[model samples]
Target: MIRMFIRDEAGFVVSAELVLIATILILGLIVGLSSIQHAIVSELNDIGVATGNSNQSYWYTGFSSEKDFANGGFSAYTRGSAGNDTQDDCDNDQCDISCDVPVNEGPKSL
Candidate 1:
């Protein structure tokens, strides 16, 4: 008489199949997450480029929107007045000043 043996009849094959499916699922999840990360990075890079272009255009053309022009003027005046008033007050008793300072009064024209 001859005896026949059953292959993976103890649920081992089923468990191996489950493990393989789980591994594939995990790998898919990893790839999905990486794609999402890449998309976010790409979007951020695009936004950065757009903002840089806007700033460059503003500076290059010496053209600013109303809000930007107002803010720039305020900042320029504030910066010009910042140390001068304090120095003048310390040097003398009164805050004597002049408005002859031109906007963008630097070595290079902007």
Candidate 2:
């Protein structure tokens, strides 16, 4: 039985074909995933830009009123202000996929 199995080549071709097909599928999957990652990063960058561009500043005028009633007087006051400047740290910059490391020279002798 061992000798017969060793000489058996019936499934050899099928195994080789499976390996080739699996390799191709894995390569394709890697390429597809890389593309998806890029697309998602770009979209997120766009969203960040949009959010940064939006201004949340607001202002409302203040009011003061005084009413006198038979015995006492009532007074009301309100203050308004504006804030929230549109300052985006990204500055509408797109997402960079590459690593940008600064090269340092070797240590200098004292």
Candidate of highest lDDT = 2
lDDT of 1 by residue, 1-110 (tens): 13335433454455788999999999999999999999997796667555544422211223333446644543222111121122222232233334785677568775
Runs with alpha carbons beyond 4 Å of true place in candidate 2? 1-14, 68-74, 84-86, 94-110
On residues 4-101, what C-alpha lDDT tens digit does candidate 2 reach at each position?
A: 99899776465788999999999999999999999998898888778867777877788767687675665877887767676665656644557878
**lDDT for each candidate structure:** 0.54, 0.79
- Which pairs clash in the backbone of model 2? none
Clashes of each: 0, 0
**Global local distance difference test of model 2:** 0.79
TM-score of each: 0.38, 0.63
- Could you list the CA RMSD of all candidates, in the order they appear? 25.0, 5.1
**lDDT of candidate 2 at residue 9, scale 0 to 100:** 77
